[model samples]
Target: MTPSQRTLLWVYAAIIAMWPIRHLAIWFIFRKLDILTPDSPRLTMDHPPLVTAIIPAKDEEGTLAECLASVCAQAYPNLEIIVVDDRSTDRTGQIAREFATADPRIEVLTIEHLPPGWTGKTHAAQQAADRARGDWFWFLDADTRHSPENLEIVMEYARDRGAALTSLLPEMRCETFWENVVQPLAGIVLMQSYPLFRVNNDRSSLAFANGQYILIKRSAYEAAGGHHAVRDRFVEDIRLAARVKALGLPIRVAIAREIGSTRMYASLDQLVRGWSRILYDALGRNPWRLLGRLLDPLIFSQTGHVAFVVALFLLARGHTSPFAFWLLGLSVVHHIFTYTVLARVYHMSVPRSRYVAWFPVANLVMDVILIRAIKMCLTGRVTWRGTAYGPTVTSSTRPVTKPVSPN
Candidate 1:
């Protein structure tokens, strides 16, 4: 081989070596991390502060009843639930009303019109917070199911940590084959971008949260401008967390695998659209950062697969060498080890991790979604909950009002 080609081969080998080392370090970090549960002694019922739970619903009739039921069953004593029915064509409003009628603490608000510049979910959350009368405001999605002690546990954790904001990364419940494969990949990407350890550290500016379960002090919420502060952003959860961190307030994030679970999407199509709406904005509005974020995964995590492909191509062309063979072996081993670590971190079963051979395919699917999302964001054609939003039309220039519904 030429000198240039030999140098390139050495670089490839170096890249392959780094993959396992990086993942091994990550696995060690994850093992040392703590996951929160409802049974912890730190969580107690003593003088529990009043909390208001806000849920935003739009065409969520199928999951509304169960979600509301879970919220109503919280072990915390002083709690109120508000369900915002944001122009649902389904029976979301009816299901909410049934809950309200049976429980005095539950109230239903119907929103008919989405104000200009505000995303539907943020708008609904803002309205519910305005009507809330509690020391803490809990924002939850309609699709999440909480354990009976979830609220009590999270509230106590926040108070003990002296945190102004707290959010939990719910255990992802995946039933379908695609869900199992793709969900783990998504989690890897998210964790890599925002390391949990750094996010939990008060000194670090990095902040992240799952919108499925977020609890913030009412004062902090208002001081940070609430959902209205991130009214135009697609990933409001992370943005709000950043806002809290920017103000030098303490924010805690932990794994809630046992405390609560959420099935983000029921099918593949829904999953694609849901993540597309998030990845584009979460990476940033800058084109260079978006491209870097998209390429980083392929280079860092999927290097083994890429090397394997290149080795096969060289062999097919009747060009073979010891370096190429060594690269292939190292790449395959690295890929297997990386996937094994990921399965353990995500709590996947043994048989599931054995499907590590499909890692390349999964990475390809994710890359496609990222590219499509970037294109949509650039074109201002991103759609969520049957509403199309543009980049330029995000400021709330008009006043928001609640719709009167005869229920």
Candidate 2:
């Protein structure tokens, strides 16, 4: 091998060294996180603060009923449910109304028109908050199904931590084969992208929140300008968390399997589109960062698989590098450790955790999501739940300003 090629091999080997460190460190940090479970000590209050569960759903007829039912069944004494049907061209409104009729605590709001500058969800949430009579607002997605004790447990956690904003990273309920193989891996990537270690730290400026299950103090939410502050953000959850953090209030996220569960995407098509949108926003719509994310699998965690194969080929051609073998060894051990951790902490079923062995295929899926996200960013528009949004707030370079109203 040429001297230049030998030096390049060393550079590559150094990069490979990072794979195990990054994965294992993240796992350890995850292990240290205090997760809220059914058995966790519940917070008792002389008078519990009212919690308003606001669900913003568009064409979510299939899932809205279950979500509303879960909210209605909350163990917390003072709780109310508000369902927002955001221009759904389906039975979403009807289902919500049925639930409202059955339960006095439940209310439905039908949004017939979306203002020009606001995204459908933020607008719906903003309107709901305006009429809500609660000290706290729980913004939940239609896909989420909570345990009876879920709200109580989260309220306990939030109170104990003194957090102004608390979001749970739910136990993902993955049923399909593809979902099982890809979902956990997607979460791992997302965790890396968001870096919960700093997010949970009050001193750190970095912050993130899961929109699927978020609990925010009404005062804090309003003080940070509520969803209206992050009206145009595709990743409003994260932006809102930043807003709260900027106000010197702590925002925290925890792995709360017993608190609730959510099936984010029902099929492969939904998975692709949903994940692409999230990845696009996570990268901050920066083309360079998107490119780096696209190349992550090629050079980082999964690089060892392809590098090992090439190493074998080079050996057959009487060309060999010790670093290649070193990296191959590292990748193999890393996968084994990761799969073990998955079985131990992530997936309840050992067989399901074995899906981590399919990392190579999952990496391909990640690449595809990255590509789709890049395309969306370049087009300057993202279609989510049948709504297309462009730059629509002052946060971006081009601002689209309009009043928040119902027509």
Candidate 3:
């Protein structure tokens, strides 16, 4: 090869080498929080803040009633539940109205018209927050089923820590094929990218929150301009977290393994639709930047290399040597160490985590999905919550009606 070509090859090698090096730094430096069942703290408040539970539902009738029932059953002393029916063509509004009638603490609003630059969910949530009478606002998805003790536990944690914003990384219940394959990758990427240590210290640029369940102090939410500030953001949770940190608020996040759970997507199509909605914005549109994220699985998943070495030994036959065997042994050791560490930190069962052993193929599949997601995002053809969203999209400015009780 010519001198220039060789130099270019070396540059490419360095680029590839940089990814794993960065991941190694993250794994070593990121502090992990204790993940076992936590003990309840003694009450320190004379009167706990009134917690407002906000649900933004769009064609989510199936899960709306159960979600409402769970919130009503919370052990927290002071609570208000608000469900925003974001132009649902289904029975969402009717279900919410029925719940509100039986319990006056519940209020339902119907958003007949959506405004410009506002993502549907956030728009509905913003309206709900505007009408909320609670000291704290908890934004929850329609699909998540909460335990009765959910609010009490989270509120205590929030008060003790003086958190401006807090979110629970619910225990994921994966029953489908797509869920098993894709869900593990989410935790892997999260562990690899946003190490818990740096996030707690509030020093790094890596900011994140699962939007499924985020609780923010009312004052903090309003001060940060609330959901209005992130109306245009596809990945609103991270954007909101970044805004919270910018405001110098004390932000706390924890894994709610036993507190709550969700079945995110039941089918592969729904899974892709859910992820694709935010992929381009999540990684940004720059190809170079996206390539950086594409390499994370490799850093986290070394088991694929072991399989390669085994295949190489079989193919080499007579050509196999002591050095080859030594290399294979090292790869096995690396694979075992990485997966074991992951299992402990994330509170994952080792049996289920053995799935990490096939991460190479999974990584490749994730890359394709990401690429497709990015393409959809760039083309302005992203659809979410049964609504087609694009750069040219606009909402009707017509005023909406306040919901009336079913009775």
Model 1, 314-337: lDDT tens per residue? 778877877667667767776777
lDDT of 3 at 102: 94
Q: Model 3, 1-407: lDDT tens per residue? A: 35664564444344345545544664665346523233544234668878899999999988888778878887777888889999999999989988888998888899988777788888888899988999899999887777767777777777777778887777777776667667666555444445556555565656667788999998889888889999877778878877887887777777665667776777777766676555566655444455566655544454347444764775488646544454454455555555555554334521244455445555666677666665764586777777777876666686475866645
What TM-score quantifies how close candidate 2 is to the native fold? 0.87
Whole-model alpha-carbon lDDT for candidate 3 = 0.70
Clashes of each: 0, 0, 1
Candidate 3 at 271: error in angstroms?
1.9
How displaced is residue 164 in candidate 1, in Å? 0.7
List TM-scores for all candidates, in order: 0.90, 0.87, 0.83
> What range of 10 consecutive residues in model 2 has the weakest lDDT sum?
398-407
Model 3 is weakest, by summed lDDT over 10 consecutive residues, at 345-354
Which candidate tops lDDT? 1
Q: How far is candidate 3 from the true structure (C-alpha RMSD, Å)?
A: 4.6
Candidate 2 lDDT over 39-73, as tens digits, reads 98776887999999999989998888888888888
Q: Name the runs in model 3 displaced over 4 angstroms.
A: 1-31, 34-38, 42-46, 202-206, 298-310, 313-318, 321-334, 341-354, 357-361, 397-399
Residue pairs in candidate 1 whose N, alpha carbon or C atoms collide under 3 angstroms: none
Error of 1 at 118 (Å): 0.3
